[model samples]
Target: MSTVKDVSKDSLHSTEKVADTDSSGTSSIHGAEAAVFEKRVWWKLDLSVLGVITMFYLLSWLDRTNLGNARVAGLQKDLKLTNDQYSIALTVTFVPYIIAELPSNLLLKVVGPDRLLPTLLTLWGIVTTLQGVIHNYAGLLACRFFLGLLEGGVLPGLVLYLSLFYPREHLQKRVSAVFASSSLAGAFSGLLAAGIMEMSGKGGRPGWAWIFILEGLFTVIFGVFTFFVLPSSPSRCSLLSEKEKEYVIQRLREDGAISKDDRADAFSWGEVLRAFQLPQVWFSLFIFFFHGTILYSLSYFAPSIIQGLGYTANQAQLMSVPPYAAAFVCTLVLSYIADKYHCRGAVVMFCGTCCVVGFAMFLSSHNHAVQYGSLFLTLSGINTGAPTITTWTANNTAPHVRRASAIAVVCMFTNIGGILSTWLLGSLSAPPRYTKATAVLLAFAVGLTLFAAINTAYLYYQNKKKAEIRATITKEDEPAGLGDRSAWFEYIL
Candidate 1:
């Protein structure tokens, strides 16, 4: 078996002294060798792991948000549904959606993401296709509910899955890759919806029906493809040899020094209980919820909002493409900056500011050009939160089980934000400026600013305490089930 390199006696002595007060984990491997090996492993994972996850996320986003395109293309009129009922359908999906995430994440501990995530997409894709043929509002609601039930856990599951492979410092961009793909998917959803909607009446169905049918089937094809390809863990990746895999796993374990608890890696209710006891998880939930309101509002309503700007449905579909494209680019750029600088909270605050500015502009404007421009700013703000927040929380939470559970807990509340957004934007707001909707979303943008700052300050204080604790406590005195509470554990600010 491959092993970590040994430190020189003098070097080991120095590190031991430093470790008594330092919060960062110490590595036995030589720095140069560690860097080279880590670089190679990461390069391979970027190609194999990150790309596949991004593709899955794109497909997921397409399946979830295409309803916006469909709505623009006459789903509401076709189903003979009133606005409140349509909003209820949106809300209904999130109910099961929110309810499913925690258990789904906990279940991820049992099944592994490679096995569980694809099953979710494949099943949801089938449900999505069935939506194309639905005769009435009730069928739409049922399909939506099941879609929620299936799709709810995919994000948190994917987040937890990623936390397994990456060290905390290197996690944001990889996680961003998953969330950023949604923007690309939004763009694709518009372009694809534009093309697919043309198939309307060709098979005795509306263009909107074709949108659902084609996107859903495509999702199924990709989900099945992913099922065969995605590796369960970094050690399982085919790109690395057995030695490299062991080295990779060992280094990751070292990086997560909060794993003082023997039971931490094991799947157990005790770990779940430990996750519930974390204060940071609760703080993260508030930010996730605030961000989710903007996220869901923007993704699910942009096409309709554009159409309401006096553009035709087709025009709205095409117009919806640019802001999301910009958001995708912005998400990547900011993710890089955040990861490079360890500035996740700062980046999140910046994105939230973008939303505030964007919404302020949108609310002030009657001009379609100005409103459209505002979308670029607003959506750039909206789509970037998932990566930053997930990484931030994952960075602080440790051991396999609690991190997984923390991710699920915060993500559950995030979707709950989506439920509220549907009502705020969908039920109460309407065409020609959506004043109430924009205002509420603007308020959420401001809230993101407040909470991101507070959380950052709180984590900074906690990190200081962890450092002090490390100074006072020797390894032999450390207790089990410590997880993130481990004295050696440091929160990323």
Candidate 2:
């Protein structure tokens, strides 16, 4: 039997070996030297990568959800769209969106995110800008479908991309930074919509036209900038010194981070299938699916919901700002806490409970103040829950290809909720009060809370079982592979 001291010494020696190994599996940098480089350079690397990706996601989300703002700014009135036709337009976006996610993520691996993401952004920007010129319902439908097709890969692609740069324990805060951009975009879209709608009849175009044109143009410009600024991978980054790059790679290896394999490895269908076999993947899918239904419905309908409460269009747009802003702040704080504690399941459950409570309040109340206050709870809950689930899923998956496939699968299923939300919230049958929609939202929230609780318990059970297995293993019997399935690679609960 190995003594505790012997196990501790072996662990220290193993960690040292991990820090020194180079791409060819020979010792290069001293462990202390690599540690110093990491301590000094990690922040600079994180800032550059996180800043650009956050901005990209912000614009992507703004273009994707800005239709809600446009609707309140007279898109339906200008296009002579009935409520069902408008809902159909929204639903159409998710068809191509869902279909494109897995393929685009696979392509992202083959081509590289720096190349593929920017190209997708540019094409979607053009499509979004063209939405401004649509004369009738069919044109709107066509633009929205293509827009979804082009935009589908971005969020999932970025999630996979970030996994390359950061370790599991450090991921949620960074992922939250990207996800929070959506909330910030939500807030900015409201304020921008109010200002842009003031340009009604400018250049012989309606205010909603200006909203799409101007925002889409902004996305195009930023997409161009991103092509130049974003680095493809830590090993290939021009911004880092050779030593810094090596240190980054070494730290990731020690942390059992994703994609430790050389990028030259052939695409493995076996690995892709293995990703689908993980229970975590399906759990993550359900979590995102339920949360997304509530999240998208709120994003698409909040302004109208507020307007139905007796505010003018501009007032409703402005009022929409607070809920999103509240969500933005809460997402960042909750993600930071989750990462610090290494407790994603707990954070997700808490957020789901908030969603359940918030929606229940909205369903039961008639007072505008109480209802509006409930929006804060709903947005904050759903927004925080999203990144927690995403990061948790990403953290558990490994090898670049498998992570890509898992993320795509998770995102593909989640967007199905986007389609469902359009009809559920945008139905002509539930105007003014939208009582039916609110009730459905409440049911989804309850489901989310239940799902999260069950997931947490299962994770705990898995962890306990893994602990028992680890206790029986001697150093000589340890697995050679890295990542979550390895005997030493415990899942972050």
Candidate 3:
């Protein structure tokens, strides 16, 4: 095994040779030594990078989804809110949320993730904590809006950050880990809410209030810790030695990773416009839109759904836990299989099929046992498919700013589904049998299945075209620069 020092020296010596642009502008590697070095350092990178981002996402989801838990803990009753008003509170968040994602991602490119992500986390934590103190519908709406505004950048920002470190083939599992953290947070939020509800009158605060306060505090603490813990990029990560860092960067180069020059360039409106031109970006937006409908509906309404099954409020909270826990496990497994086989499209379509079946079962069955069992499939399927779609978009896009814009645009459109979900599921008139809402969600699930199939077929066609081009083009005839347009850059299906 080559030592870190040995790898670093070899990498430095090879830089000139690697930088040479033969029409493709991609580096060729001296194989086995590079492979050995990568294997040696990847585990450390995964632990430090993926671990911290996953934690941040966990806390973000915990704070965001706790509103559902709070609603069950008597938030609506105390605020004297009708179901429509409560729905408005949820819907208002996405106003700022959608407007902020694109600009925030652009800002992230300027300030860097280490600084930007923690700052967003801390601000959202403050907003989340303030939700505990809101007395009226107006106050609650204000807090929710700010919470969404502050949180808008997190998912897209983290996706872009991960893209900087991992190759296209390796991204699905890391993205899944971050998403599984969200599922784990959903499960944990239920248990935590159940416990916090026990503090209903403690310190002159209601149980729902306590849930926000405690979870927000936890987020703030973790956000502060992340600022010190997360390195901005591979080259800046202090946890690794110089040689390890060299190996990481070298491997990325060999794999045709986006260059630092592309990442560090000044933000351009041209890149943003180019992102919109890509068909994959539009397909991703539609895919995630339906995905958001299912995901946010569950995150915000699962407890209510469980309560509708005639469980007690507390029992409903506990029942919510199992679906999310199942989702956490299934998401990890599904993502692992997708990455291992390099079959993102197939895995996504499979997960979408599960969602469709789950929703169909929910609509057709009146038996509580059958409905409850369906919750597991619904949560697991949507959770698994959401990250897969996100990773798919991120993987196919190129250059840092364009990727950022593409993700932000997809997230922006997708979250409109969030707003729709709140209105659809939070209807005051639709009580125990929200039959209408379930039917709508079922339609969304069917839409997801259709979108996944279409997107997969499109990607297959593009890959076939790229393969043909690669066969005809000489090295000197290949498209240059770091973008995905290179003749050799095939889309991952």
Candidate 4:
């Protein structure tokens, strides 16, 4: 169990590995430590962890967003719900979600991912399954709200978990890759839901019930698999070679601190307050709120939107697959670039710009093809930029008390956007098109673009200052010093 300070020291060690050595009274500087071998080791660990986290997240999303499919398959009719009542169901979930977010994230740091995440994922899956059995709107509301409570930790937990395994520079791509699974879930949900809905008359269950039952069951099964398979951190990963573990530790040390231990003293109210005070936290939260507003509103209503274009329910669900697929491709490509360039801010800005164009097109277009293309654009923006922002913000924080607190606070604020989106695109906004929802999404896209720009500028300013400080301090003083010298190296807007 290395202290965060030890981890910090390791990072400094990584930067100095290519030190000057005296040979025959001549100075010779060593080259970087085997970049190819180190990178191969990194990639191996990345693939293993990425595979486990991606599948875990895919189930997480399918359980939550599949409700959109259920809605179209007679859930509202069975509950005798008005549009407002459905929005209320969505809104109620966010209440517990917001309340639980920070607590849950802090708990993840306390208990560690090995025990906490899989347990919560399994519990939420069971809760999701209960929605199928609910006979009334009250019951559905209860299930959804509890589901949110169980799920509140998932995104932030994963963000915090990945921080333990990767460097800040490497994190953006990994995050983007993992988040692309959500787009895959959207596509898969559509495909799977279409099949399940087709089984409407079988087993004496409604199509909506079948959607919940099948998806929920799959989630539980996957959760159990994650428990056995997911690595707690690079230090404990069975698949990594000893050299790889050293490499991982060194790379992480080179970047910033992340914990491998269960940080028991991780929950501090003062640190939590400080997290909230940071402009980076608030900026990302605000952007995520609007980002979620656009993302969930479109994801939940996408099939319905296509159905509004005169297609049947099944046809609409089928049509939903393409945009998600396109988003997946674009997100992965952008993630690779972001990681390669070590420029998360620039990548996110470009993605946000794309979202603006997509949302604007959706708002104004009458042609179905153009509208469908806009779906791709909007998703590319939210899906591509979201993971970058999340990974970027998370990696910028220190480990333990502050990191857990900040992740939770940011996530809590972000989920509020989900609640707001539900209300913004009430069922009443459908049919000829939810003009109100589209317009709001466009406005938010512009806001997010500007926010991303400001965030980029702040990061660049801080980076510039760090460079100046490094230039002032010679390499010899670097190892024993720099504690207060780069103290204001913050990610803020």
Candidate number of the best TM-score:
1
Per-residue C-alpha lDDT of model 3 across residues 218-306, encoded as one tens digit per residue:
88888888888888888888777775676567555544556545443457788778898888888887888888878998899999989
**Looking at model 2, which ten-residue stretch has the lowest summed lDDT?**
1-10
Regions more than 4 Å wrong, model 1: 6-34, 257-262
lDDT by residue for model 1 (311-409), tens: 898989999999989999998999999887778899999999999999999999888889989999999888887789888988888787788788888
Model 4 stretches with alpha carbons more than 4 Å out: 1-33, 259-268, 427-430, 473-493
Candidate 4: Cα lDDT at 426: 68
Backbone clashes, each candidate? 0, 0, 0, 2
Q: lDDT (CA) for every model shown?
A: 0.83, 0.83, 0.83, 0.75
> Tens digits of per-residue lDDT for model 4 on 1-493?
1112122132222322222223344342223444455466768887778887877788888887887888877788878999899888988877887888778887775687988999988899899888988899899999999998888888888888887787776677778878999999999988998888887878777889988887888788888887888887787898887646765775665454544333423566766666666666677777777777777787777777777777788888888899899989988998888777667778777887898898788778899888878888887778887788787777666645667777777777778888888877765466556787778788888888787778778667776887777667765565431221234333422
Per-prediction TM-score to the true structure, in the order listed: 0.93, 0.91, 0.92, 0.88
Clashes of 3: 0
Against the hidden true structure, what lDDT does model 3 obtain? 0.83
